[model samples]
Target: MPSESSTLHTPAEARVRPVQQWWALSGRGVAKVFRNGEFVFAFVSPAFLALCFYLPLSALMDVYGVDYAQFLMPIIVLQSVGFAASSAAMRASFDDTEGINTRFRVLPMPLVVPMFARLSTNAVLLVVSLVCAAVACLIIGWRPMGGVVGTIGLFVVALIVGLLLGLLADGIGLMAGSPQATSQALVFPTLILGMASSGFVPVSQFPEWIQPFVRNQPISQFVDVMRAADTGSLTWEILRPTVWWCGGLFIAAVLLLRLGNQKVRA
Candidate 1:
């Protein structure tokens, strides 16, 4: 007669494949975003920013020889991307605080799968946010004059930036002591960076003392490249600073991820 253990299933038999595991978690994340009304905020935020800023400020920008609607599109789109990233941070913090991530640690899956799943969900939201921002821009009289290649480049840059920011935010969520702290930590930096950028006004409009800082900051570099791409005037010189900024963001994200993983292990 066979022993009882011989007839029972092994732990390995019960384990799911890593790919399946990743997809399942990703589906869960995406479903939560939709079910909890995150999609509604995803649509509302860019539209709100576009209407609030464009209507009152278009005439002021026109006086300075700038087309406000067109000029505001990049920053508006970027702000939506920022919102998506912030949402990712909040989700990460919730998962950690709720012990979901801790439960994930005991699962029969690769350690990186959860992170990748979160990334996939973030990507989905990022695209949705971008589309909403584009619609908002259209309503405000912004047109894509960038031609096919330049337009593609414009979105490509936004995606890259958004993903990096999302990763950074993910790390912040993992390491932050609480969800409220994560939200508080993100608020000032986003505001300071967005407002100080060359996105809304000409660099000359900034105080002469701060012009040098405003001209060379990461946000300003991104805006310059985006604006150049919009006009089909993008050149290597205009893109160099953005490349450097991407490299810095990449390094920061990697470091943050490492730190976050350490915290999780602890």
Candidate 2:
């Protein structure tokens, strides 16, 4: 008979195969989420919210020039990803309450499976929302400065940012007792953070007190970097701020995920 010791491996090896399996599980979960009417509603309803918000900005189109659309396009993508990522937290809290975690733990699975599965699923939803947004932008007369490739790059950036945000949200859901509270607590930050970008209005037009800070922020820099590849030329000046933001978020995400791991699902 094989020794019991032969059956054992380091936690490192035990975790490796499970992580790969977890990613495959995430792919299936995302496909399932797309089919759920309720989840689809959660995914697409925000574009409606945007149309209402865009009404006031319509007249500004004449005053600001069609150029405004170029800037607005990137903002919509960023906001879509940011908002959708928060759903991962809500989903996690709901699943935990439903006792989904217990069943998952009993399976030969990575404990991180459900958490990231929901997150990756929401990230996929954000991609759908972005395509819808691109359509809206074209219908409303928005044009990208860079062109097709540049616009696509902007979408990619939005997805990466959304992925990081979803990871953060998953951690948030784990620590908070209720999804409503966690979701609500996150709303303020989400709204305010996007405002700091160049999408809503030009930074040059912002009040003297607010202009300096928002202009220097990551979202604005990201908008510039992504837009440069399409509308303008790609340069370090445009890419640097986005790079910095992603780097910071990467560290914070790892730390938060680590903290959440202490909760032990069983």
Candidate 3:
């Protein structure tokens, strides 16, 4: 007869142990992030970005009657969200390239388990990035001017945006063929959207020719909503575009994840 320990390794046992598997995999992902020093980068990136923009542009922004510190907070936080999503993509890409995802497929556990574990890891990192971003904003003199409910709303919006972006990035990583390619693919768009958006300066600052694009882009809308939330001035007109953008992101993430899952099964 087969050994008792071997019998415990049957498919039925594996199916029952998905929770354990998810926890273990989540731990592994978190550990890898620490080992690779991404945890440190999570703190450093936001702080660096804040200082880089704040020191040079504060005087100029003040010329426009803007408090640069307050004006700059939303983008810094959003950039941190972007960082978390990029990290998620890299983690997924590494898993794909190293065949770790393939190995998981051979296991008897549900196909969704690994994806959930990765999402858990992404969630942890996203929260850390937001906290660090908050610290950076505080140091630069960004305060919560919107009272208790508004402050909570500010972060709630950020967390929702971060999670959706993370899900989208994870799907992209799985679909990409290589980690280098994944990084390149994400970097250009991130740079373009971030720089082109109203996050850095008022949309009126742009030339009349490009102003329409700058004003109407998704990133600009996100920044506007976040700023309104912080100042207790959010209106339906300001928030409607963001709601639609978020809905679109959700749909895109779901479709990409399904396609990625199919690619793996194939």
Q: How many times do residue backbones clash in model 2?
A: 4
What C-alpha lDDT, on a 0 to 100 scale, does residue 28 get in candidate 1?
Answer: 99
Give the alpha carbon lDDT tens digit for every residue of 1-266 in model 2: 66666567555677697778778878876766666553556536546645755677767865867455555667776666665667677766666666777677778886767666676677767777777767766765667766677667767777778788788777777667678778786787777767766777778888889887788877777676666766658777678778888888888777876776666453
Best by lDDT: 3
After superposition, the stretches of candidate 2 with alpha carbons farther than 4 Å from their true spots are 1-28, 35-39
In model 1, residue pairs whose N, Cα or C atoms come closer than 3 Å (at least 3 residues apart or on different chains), thus clashing, are: none
Candidate 2: how large is its RMSD? Answer: 3.9
lDDT of 2 at 48: 61
Name the lDDT value of residue 252 in candidate 2: 78
Badly placed stretches (over 4 Å) of model 1 are 1-16
How large is the C-alpha RMSD of every model relative to the true structure?
A: 3.1, 3.9, 2.7
User: Candidates ranked by lDDT, best first?
Assistant: 3, 1, 2
TM-scores, one per candidate: 0.93, 0.82, 0.94
Give the Cα-based TM-score of candidate 3 against the true structure.
0.94
For candidate 1, what is the lDDT?
0.90
User: In candidate 1, how many Å is residue 216 off?
Assistant: 1.3
lDDT of 1 by residue, 1-266 (tens): 76768657544544657788999999999999999888899989999999999989999988878889889999998999999999999988998899888898887777788999999999999999999998999999999988998888898999999999999999999988689999998988999988987987888888999999889998888888888898899999999999999999889888987888778767
Q: What is the lDDT of residue 191 in candidate 2?
A: 74
